[model samples]
Each structure stands twice: as structure tokens, then as C-alpha cells.
Target: MKKILRVFAALAPLLLAACAPTQLVRNKGDAAALAQQAAREQKLANANHWVLEGKLGVSNGQDAGSGGFTWTQDGNHYEFVFRTPITGKSYRLTGSPDGAELDGADGGPQRGPDAEALMRRALHWEVPLDELRAWVLGLRAQGADAELSFGNDRLPSMLQQDGWTVTYPLWDTTRQPPLPAKVFAEKPPYKVKLAIQSWTMQ
Candidate 1:
């Protein structure tokens, strides 16, 4: 009986340790920040009609290009124009829910079912225009899961979605609801950087 009691006493601590609940470490501020972000997103969701003027830089680990751009969005329709300073050439991409068209490429004009495919086929640029429209505004794109890290300002410091990592280094707080001033997105060899000069929201 003494030997059995010694063995049982030794196993008691192990059994209690195994039955103990696990402790979870969490940051209390994270929940508040996420709620703020959600509210911001809701406020900006209806801000679809706007014009953004900026400088765009794109690279594919080999070829690179930088140009001034004007993006005008009206609900489901959008028009994006790019002007190259060095080449003095201009390209315009316009589309709606129907289809997309890319004008002023190497060839005459290219038409496709979507902007992403049209851009890739016409300009050899691998940019996700559908997702970018939302990301440019510091909001996560629809139809995809995203992971966001908040900065000290409670704004998003980094956002990862659709296989791309986007970082907002600056924000225009002067606006009613702050907007991203500089949006940089990268996925491996492909990188797209935008330095927004001005924003006109309607």
C-alpha cells in the first residue's frame, strides 16, 4: 500500500498539469483597433466615385516603368490613364461591368473580358486591377480573405490578400476619412508602387 500510494502521488501532479487550461496571450488594443478599421471601411465603402492622380511605378524583377497616372472611378465604371515621361506615350484603360478595353499599347487597341487579363496580354504587366481598386483606398478587397496589421495610428500598416502584400507608409489625414498617400504592393518578382499626389472624391 505504501508503494502504490507513492506512485499515485507522483502521477497526481502530471495529471493535474495535463488537465490545466491553456493560457492565451492577446493584445487588448487589437480588438478596438479592428473595430475602428471596420467603421472606417464602412464609411468609405460608398466612396466609389473619385479621381486619383498619382505616380505609378511597376517592376517585374527585369523590366520596370514609372509614369504619371490619373484614375477616375464612377461606381462600377472606371478609367485609368497613364502618361510616360521618358517615352512621351500615353495609355488608357477603360472598363465597366460589361467588358474592358486598353488603348495606346504597342499595338492598336486590346479588348478583353477583364482588366487584369487585358493588362497582362496588352502591356505585359501583371497587376491585379480588381483587387487594387480597393487596396488603393486602404480597404481590403472583396471576395478574398485578408490579414491586416495596424500601425500606431490605428490605420493599416500592412495588408496581405490575394497573394500580394501591400503596405501603406503614409496617409492623408487631412481628408475627412484618411486615405493612403503611398501604397506599395509586392508579390515576389512583381512590385507596384503608387505615390498619390492628389485625391478628388465626389
Candidate 2:
């Protein structure tokens, strides 16, 4: 009993340390510096291509859904595959700036002029797919005025743009260009949440 008590006493400190909250060392900065960082990162992302796998959730006043997705973006071309648990069906959307295509579980392929419009009409999900590419990269989409709030790490903690508010709560620091572990966006009747599991950059 004495030996067991001593072992437990020795482990207490280790256990406490393990349970302690992680201390984040921030990149302290002013607004200008934070904005500069955002711009730089955005430029970097746009110049390169990436593939991300994650879970995505969306909700509107009338409709709501969640799914797992694989997104691949190369220059101006992008391909997205979403698997929804609700219908146990997978949808594939591929597009460039010029046009978009969606293939449903029924194997019927639909093409359109705009991805978001097409999705709204076909899936009843109002998501700005094009703007999301920039949002996912921690940048504001073009053609919109953005208001940004920075976290301790000098990265965006919250952003308001184009009628949507996006929040970044988790980050992955292992990659050359660290990415968000979770991203949530809300715009009135529409909301989007993305929980990124992996990232591959080229």
C-alpha cells in the first residue's frame, strides 16, 4: 500500500501537467500588420494548389444538412466531392471560373453557369462555393469589403464580408502553410461549418 501510494503521488504532477490548457504564444501586432499577414497568406494560397478533406455542415432557416467533403483546387479549376449522411448519397461538383458541373447519386450530371446558383436550385443548399475557396484560405473573397478581428496568433479569428461572418477557432500548425482545423460561416438564413481533417498542398 505504501509503494502504491508513492507511485500515485509521483504521477499526480504528470497528470496535472497533461490536463493543463495549452498556452498559445501569439504573434502580437497592430491592425496593419495583421492585415498584411492575411494578404500575404492569401496570395500564397492563390498562387498554389491544394487538396483538403473535411466535414462540412450547412444550415438555413428552411433547410439543414451536414456531410464529409474532399476539395481539390488547382489554379482556376476545382473539384468537390460531398458525401451526406442524410440521404447516404454522394454528390460531385467540379468547376472552373467559366462553368460548373454537379453529378448526383442518380448519376445524372447537371451543368450550369454558376456553382452557387446551380447548387441552390438542385440541392436547395445556398453556399457560395467560389467565395468559400478564399474564405477557407483565411482570406476575404474578392469584390467584398471585409472586417477582420485577429486572434493571439495574429490570424483572423473572425471576419465579416459579403453578408457572411466567418469564425476560425482551430488551426493546424504542422503544415508549411498551416491551415484551419475548423471554420464556421454564417449569413442570415445560411450557415456553413467546415472541420478540416487533412490538407495536401502543391
- Number of the top-ranking candidate, with TM-score as the measure: 1
Name every residue pair that clashes in candidate 2. none
lDDT of 2 by residue, 60-150 (tens): 5554556679999988999999875544567899998899999972438989989998888777677987678887877778888988776
Worst 10 residues of 1 by lDDT: 19-28
Error of 2 at 91 (Å): 0.4
Model 1 Cα lDDT, one tens digit per residue, 20-98: 3233122223877898888889999888899999877766665566677999999999999987664467889999999
The parts of candidate 2 lying over 4 Å away from their true place are: 1-39, 42-45, 105-107
Candidate 1 ranges with C-alpha deviation above 4 Å: 1-29
| TM accuracy, model 2 | 0.78
For each candidate in the order shown, give its overall lDDT on alpha carbons.
Answer: 0.79, 0.72
The TM-score values for the models, in the order shown, are 0.84, 0.78
